[model samples]
Target: MAIVVNLDVMMAKRKMSLNELSEKVDITLANLSILKTGKARAVRFSTLEAICKVLECQPGDILEYVAD
Candidate 1:
């Protein structure tokens, strides 16, 4: 199974930067980078909610499932 995070794609579509998102989401750059790079093992619902609100996107827009 493979789960892909389209964070960078959404950020680009929204014309937002890493640092900007970090500040808006109140997430550390390191942690956000981990999530953005699809290295995160998990993410809290609240964190996800904040991201969605800040980016004006849905969780489905940032997440994808692939059969491997």
Candidate 2:
């Protein structure tokens, strides 16, 4: 995918576990896992906002665009 999800990197930098982030963001672990693994086809703005707020990061930090 040209749009890369860097959620794992940001989580590592923040020293956060998937479970912790899931609880903090009020999202299901399965859903977060899908996003973290770049398998999600789309993400809602509210979901992104919640994740960014919990991770103390911007959306750009978690999502990147690279040419294939």
Candidate 3:
């Protein structure tokens, strides 16, 4: 996949656990886990916004585009 999700990296940098972020973002752990593992097919803008808000980072910090 050209798009990469760097959720774990940011979480480590922020010293936050997945469970903590899940609660803070008001998202289910299972859904957040799917996203963290880069298994998600799509992410809603609202969801992205909520994650960014909780992580104190931009969308670019979570998602990256690499040419194949």
Candidate 4:
């Protein structure tokens, strides 16, 4: 199983850039990049909320569960 990150797709749909998201979410670019690229091990709710709020999306928009 895997938790697929749909960050790239969401970002594209939102017409937002990584740097812009990082700044808007008040998160570090490097860390946000890690999450964006699906390299992050976990994500905090607050951070997720911030992302959602800024992107006008829910966690589901960024996360997808894949069966093994």
Q: How many residue pairs clash in each candidate?
A: 0, 0, 0, 0
**Candidate 2 segments exceeding 4 Å error:** none
Using lDDT as the yardstick, the better of models 1 and 3 is 3
Taken over the whole model, the C-alpha lDDT of each candidate is: 0.96, 0.97, 0.98, 0.94
Error of 2 at 16 (Å): 0.4
List where candidate 4 sits over 4 angstroms from the true fold: none
Better of 1 and 4 by lDDT: 1
Residue-wise lDDT of candidate 4 within 1-68, one digit each (tens)?
29999999999999999999999999999999999889999999999999999999999999999988
The C-alpha local distance difference test score for the whole of candidate 2 amounts to 0.97
Q: Deviation in angstroms for 30 in model 4?
A: 0.2
- How many Å off is the CA of 64 in candidate 4? 0.4
lDDT of 2 by residue, 1-68 (tens): 89999999999999999999999999999999999999999999999999999989999999999999
- Measured with C-alpha atoms, the lDDT of residue 14 in candidate 4 is 93
Residue 2 alpha-carbon offset, candidate 1, angstroms: 1.1
Q: Pick the candidate with the highest lDDT.
A: 3
TM for candidate 2 is: 0.98
Model 3 residue 42 lDDT? 98
TM-score of each: 0.96, 0.98, 0.97, 0.96
User: Over the full model, what C-alpha lDDT does candidate 3 score relative to the true structure?
Assistant: 0.98
- List where candidate 3 sits over 4 angstroms from the true fold: none
Model 4 clashing residue pairs (backbone): none
CA displacement after TM-score superposition, residue 30 of candidate 2 (Å): 0.3
